[model samples]
Target: MRMRKILPACVLSCCLTGLMAPAAFADGCPDQEIAVETLKMKRAEDSEKAGKLKEAFNAAKTVAWECLGNDAGKRREALIKRVGRTLGDQEEKQGRLKEAFDWYLAAGLEADADRVMLKRANAKPDDTNAVGNAIDHFKRRNNEARVREMRGIAARNVDKWLTAEDKAFAARKDSREELGKARDWVYYAEAGSGKVTERAEKRGDTLATDDARRSIENAIAYYQFADKPQKAKGVRDKARKLGDEHARKGENKLAVEFYSLAGDDAKAAALEKKSEAEKQKTESARQDKFKKDQQSLEKELGL
Candidate 1:
């Protein structure tokens, strides 16, 4: 009878110990399931920060599903939101604008969806489809105020683009007229005899209006036609000065024509004396300008 009682007590104690062992192990440390899920969530967050959006999305999805499976209501909700946000971000980075917007909407971020839709609408200027889509998204969010504003902006942008196109065409036409006037000035200013006034009237004072090409051409005509050597020298000197001014301003093409009109033979003699003197002056000026510019740029950059 003693042995039977002892055996029954041993069996009961073993069963209780078996039951308590799992509980003891479970209590000794943090919850393994929650710990694993948290680690995954952290991994996802790190990946996201490192710009590995796709991997982050996968990990976040796993965490969200696990939390949901465990019946963690608040945690599940939060994880779902995080997963949706991560996926949406990934889609956006990949240029899947519509997909990203949908995900944001699913995550209950209507404002974010609207913002992305607006960006998408702006990207495709000619595509009315994108604009229509954005409008639909705004409507779904009940953002009537924003929808109306965007519609106005779209209409304004279309009108602005049309006006700009018309202006560009007009500018091109004006440039052609200016070029023709420049050519006429060159012709008239070159003519030595006859009524210089009549020729001048036809071309007008187009050269005086800062038309560098016309001015240079007129200067050339004067150098070629002047009979007296003294008059020629004076005209050539004036032309040379104009050339130098244009060269300093980096208008090399206009400068070349004027310089050529100064006559090649005269230039060769002057070059030897002027080159070294001009170099020293230009270098000094450049150094001063560079220092000033560096100071200005540093201030602008907040460096």
Candidate 2:
């Protein structure tokens, strides 16, 4: 009876050892490691397909870690990258660009990151400072080609935006919000991108100059109406420079308006008087010419 029990126990112990041997005594990379990684990858794929992005991101990370040891012929590595890039694409579609960029960076998707960087840069198309930040980032990365391209695009965008502001300023020049936004972009362009500055100042012949005067005058009026004398005075001080520019350019009518807004009533009145005189002189010349034509006609008709 003792022999029988000992023999059966020995056989049972040997069978258990045989069953556990592959995992216990195998090399660092056991055959089952590949199988385990594949199963994890499958879970990641399922999570992604189900739109469980957070879960998918976590699951894919596990698979990526597994790939470090068991990826054969780099197949698992390729799968990890593919899954990561797909997750980033999903995030991008949802307008989560920063999150998308993070995933792309993790997935080793440089091209995808580049594309998102451009879109993110232009997300606030009217905000030139926002665009400038992107340009600065690209410069740090030594992406000169992208920097040039972005500058051109940013210049055109702001130039278009300034056009809309110019039209609005003509009607709602007293709107501080509109004028402030215009100033923000104009200053950014002037500071960061000469391309934008040139387009802004040169496109409408005297677009920036004209708008500067008009904006200042409107701002002064707005502040004065709001009982903010100090603010109005400040605006008027700024208007004087614009008034001088117009006066030097022989735009007497505009100079009159700007000087008046600047609280230089004497200068404004003088310019207005000079303009009236010029208008009278022009009318006189027209009348003299008309009289000459009438006399010629009457003489020819013997009237």
Candidate 3:
């Protein structure tokens, strides 16, 4: 096109071109000939080779912040994670905890940011909200051990916050859409001490066990009414566990109830038979006592 636009590579890297670098990057990427994302990766990689870690981080972060979508999500995600994490280390080394936390989030590496959340959690054992917040990142990462650890902290506190969360689901329990929310609350609450099925079976505390039973029952009702068979089936699996445990513990009625709810007709039928036999034996004993009492009354009255 223009003569000035036709410069050789050496002429482009002169002081004039070097001074133009920032403006050129600002106006558009350095190379319009290459694909934008590829050019961006090259810029960051070049900065890294030159030991300009911040520049490299900024280049990759620009893509993450501005260019993210199907392409970046598929292709450039690892590069974004790398540069962001590398810069986060630098920031943390400089004692910029908040900055490091921000960088970790930008990298989509919430597990790294969890290190900062853990600090706040340790600082405030009684702060259930803090523990709850700390658990969320690990939950996203599917780190069950860390989530349980955070929930354990929340369990010890047992403040109004947890009660509010527990009651929130109860408040909206009747709506079909809200049942999943109820299950979520139950998951968080019972996951702390034990799962709802486990708690129901333990029978260690009357209030806790009753609450678990009611929650599971309500969940079953909601699932049936909502036609959510898959979710219902999952809860039924929980019911099976409770049924076996109750049977082992000699709670025949509860065992039969749970087994029926679990759709285990054979187990339910067996338990029901045992329960019926026990009922008949108790009735026979009652009749024998009644006859003995009648005879005593007649003898005492000289009838």
Candidate 4:
């Protein structure tokens, strides 16, 4: 048989510990990891102080990743959050709303995202793409509150646009080009209102119908400001078509408004009567729900 025997205890212990040394050293990160990460943090702070915020954000993100990879994630959470917030602020200052929102979301700051998006929506009335992108982002996240806030922002911005267009049209009332611009703004504002109305109606929200009505009124005014009735005839025909579609869907109020715009006075009057009746019925339903809720609450209170 081959000679086989256990090593001395002291020698075995030394050999085993030697074998574990590298692992233990790894568990306790190398000095270089710590030193490099620390230096990166310092660099980030210095860059921020120097107003080179983009560089600061990048360096700080590197530190965050290093800490996460080194088993220091919990210890570095606050630092990561701080870095993310700083990145959002820096990007917002640079007028990069989408980037700011992304950083705010990364920082776990939903409220900050909402605030920044609201600011962006309010500031970029003429920038349709920006507003549309922000709306789509909120919608995809199923952020109903932010969507509502954005809708208000959109409606308010539409109002501003309509006001500006109206002023422009008034100044150049005889210009067909100006009239065309007015028409375009009215369409834009109405489309914005329709978006708000659609979303709100889905949620049973009774809000902002006034905004839609105002847009419709402005649209009609734009038609009046046009050089010839023929210039507005296409829009009028479209309105009538829309009215008929709404009527088929039992949306008599909208039908009435559109028919009136299309100069179908008889149809408008008939639809207005039906619309009033529908409004009363809806109000009665709401009151019934409120009363039932009150009765349930009173019963629960033994009153």
Winner by TM-score: 2
Clashes of each: 0, 0, 0, 0
Native-to-model Cα distance after best TM-score fit, residue 51 in candidate 4, in Å: 7.0
Give me the overall lDDT of model 4. Answer: 0.63
- List ranges where model 2 is wrong by over 4 Å: 1-54, 62-76, 89-103, 119-137, 186-303
| lDDT of every predicted structure (CA atoms) | 0.59, 0.66, 0.65, 0.63
User: Which is the better candidate, 1 or 2, if ranked by lDDT?
Assistant: 2
Q: Candidate 4 residues 1-303, lDDT tens each?
A: 223344466678899898877532233567667667767777877877787866765676677444335444443455556767888988999999878988988767778987887788778855666666667777877987766665655556655654554465456432234334333443434445443223222221121122254444444454444333453565566677878998999878788888887788999998888778879999999999999999999999999
Model 1, span 214-282: residue lDDT tens: 553553343333223454465566667877787678655566666776775455345534655677899
Q: What local lDDT does model 2 show for residue 55? A: 72
lDDT of 3 at 83: 77
* TM-scores for every candidate against the unseen true structure: 0.31, 0.41, 0.33, 0.40
Candidate 2 on 250-276: residue-level lDDT in tens? 899888887887889999998889889
Q: Between prediction 3 and prediction 4, which has the larger TM-score? A: 4
Error of 2 at 282 (Å): 58
Q: Which whole-number lDDT from 0 to 100 does residue 139 have in model 3?
A: 81
Among these predictions, the greatest lDDT belongs to 2
Which pairs of residues collide in model 3?
Answer: none
For model 2, state the Cα shift of residue 244 in Å: 30
